[model samples]
Target: MSYPICHEEIIEDRDVTAQLDPRGDVAVLVPAAGAGVRLGPGRPKALRLLGGEPLLVHAVRRLAAAASVHTVVVAAPAADLVAVRELLAPVAPVTVVAGGVQRQASVAAALAAVPAGPEIVLVHDAARALTPPGLVESVAAAVRSGHDAVIPVLPVVDTIKEIGVGERVLGTVDRSALRAVQTPQGFRRGVLTTAHAAATDPLTDDAGLVEKLGVPVVCVPGSEHALKITRPFDLALAEHLLAMGR
Candidate 1:
């Protein structure tokens, strides 16, 4: 497949949710191995408390509920592998394994554990604790519909600026051309494996690795509830969002 390197045109999403039935065909990988230095230093980001429970607990629980998803694999910190397994046992049946130091390595570890049956694989950040099952299904649906790769995105509302040294504003960035990418990023299982095999330099997201191979990635609508829990304020906001039944 020839991937377009150009920006993808936005396709508005409908209100109706997909009735995804990817049973035994979709595998989800959650890379929960980050130190999360921004969320205030007590525990690994995924293990940190959110609404009186670990963030990983909320993330895995949601993915497991999706009808399309059959397997959920977690990559935990080397020290917390056993603890993470115990924490998630009651919420959902997940496979917990020791994770590598970097995010990409952790993803590769979880990817290797995914069974042979699933043709589609999704890489979701455990930090997106409140991601709705509908959004998960949407990405998976796109892949099942023959897209090689897909990701969820929200339009950027705030004005963006480019800064230079000495704190001087260099130029204003066009926000209209930009969309904030979110996860549960979906891919063909073979494409994901190939991307990992070819990766050399470090990257923040798996889609970028696929992009390096010149594959075009499509974008789907994302929910505000899928906000990543990064800073102290973000955690507090997530707590508030959860309280509102979001």
Candidate 2:
């Protein structure tokens, strides 16, 4: 089955307590419909099992745990909307929507479902399942502190190389100036909506869309625990990390 870019299905847990907290002024959008080709998938990346739970479950659980986050909207696979909603109902009060073909479209769909109360919106990846609540709070705090855009990043540590067409190394590229970026990338509600409205090309991260609008994106320290699970090796590593209580 196919769904429109803005198709949405809201699922709420009445038993769950009010989502608002002392600093609850943030909403998180999760685009989770990507097929995990790299992981040699049996299921969609977000639905893949991790530590006995779906990656989406782990991700949303953490996001819901954050004091600043008042809402979470997930863009799930069109066919799996019911399943995804059922999966998340016990975990948190979330609104599930049919995701679009591309990640950008899914984000846009999820963004549309965000209610008005939250002024700070965050775009997070479901593949980063182990991202901690602290990181969520940090990103929201940065946005709340008056920054229009905020993202988590870590310094690149590996030796860099510039490659040619035939897989030849042209030269050693500078790594000092490069940083590895991560999410839940935060933005003021107006800033994010405006960026999306003005977006032409689909970029890998929301910050890239904002960059095109001449907005300065601030970066905070990212945690190793936020490593994205993309491959089988990454899954194993995540399992190990989980066992180690990371």
lDDT of candidate 2 over 103-139, digit per residue (tens): 9999999999998799999999999998878778777
Residue 28 displacement in candidate 2 (angstroms):
0.2
Report lDDT (CA) for all predictions.
Answer: 0.87, 0.86
For residues 3-69, what per-residue lDDT tens digits would candidate 1 score against the true structure? 4222444433332234546455789999999999988869999989889999999999888877788
User: By TM-score, who's the top model here?
Assistant: 1
> Model 2, which residues run further than 4 Å from truth?
1-21
Task: lDDT for model 1, please.
Answer: 0.87
Q: Each model's TM-score?
A: 0.93, 0.91
